[model samples]
Target: MIQVTPSIAIDESELEESFVRASGPGGQHVNKVSSAVQLKFDIRRSPSLPNDVAVRLMKLAGSRLTQDGVIVIVAQAQRSQKRNREEARERLLELIRAAAVRPQTRRPTKPTKASKERRLVSKDKRASIKAGRSKPGAD
Candidate 1:
């Protein structure tokens, strides 16, 4: 089980991992060993994530989330499969933990009276400057 937070925990069975050959400067080892780890998590079916958290996860994931709502994360930075796998798990936990947070509701605020007055004053000044540019004969 992967615990993202105190309340959020995902079953290890739900995560699908795939190993593939990594590309980089590992010489013969990179050419032979399958070190890259692709971690796939289905956000739509995960019991650990709340409905709102799932929605936000989908939004935050963007193109990474498929039409079926599976979030795919690839970790290949490390040469060893174990390190790559750990990196992928860490990334998934971070993403899930971030999703678990509820964003503070933004209170809609209007411009202050002084600010509004300043804006109007600026606009008036600009308008007056433009007005002065008019030809004397054109009135």
Candidate 2:
């Protein structure tokens, strides 16, 4: 089980990883070994996540989430498959942990009177500048 947050723990079975050949630094070994890890997690179907967290996870996943609501994360930074696999798992945990936090509600506010006045004053000054640029009798 992987602990994302204090309250969220995902079973190891929930994660699926597939290996593929990576494209860097390994030279001849790179062509023969599958070092890249593709980690997939079904956020929509996960029983471990709360509904709110799941919703936020989907939003956070963005392009990473597939049509079926599976999040696909590819890790190829490391030359070893084990490191890449660990990297992918860490990324998934990080993403889930981020989603666990609730976003602060935005409180709408009106512009301050001083700010409004300053804006109007700037507009008036601009208008005057433009008016001054015109020919004296060209109205």
Top of the candidates by TM-score = 2
lDDT of 1 by residue, 1-139 (tens): 7778999889999999999998976789998899999999999998878899999888888878889999898998898999999999998888888888999999999999999999999999999999999999997
CA shift at 81, candidate 1, in angstroms? 0.5
Cα TM-score of candidate 2: 0.89
Q: Write the residue-wise lDDT of candidate 2 on 1-139 in tens digits.
A: 8888889999999999999999988889999999999999998889999999999999999999999999999999899999999999999999999999999999999999999999999999999999999998999
Q: How close is candidate 1 to the true structure, as a TM-score?
A: 0.88
Off by over 4 Å in 1: none
In angstroms, give how far residue 130 of model 2 lies from its true place: 1.2
What's the CA error at residue 45 for candidate 1, in Å? 1.6
**TM-score, one value per model:** 0.88, 0.89
**Clash number for each model:** 0, 0
The total number of steric clashes, by the backbone 3 Å criterion, in model 1 comes to 0
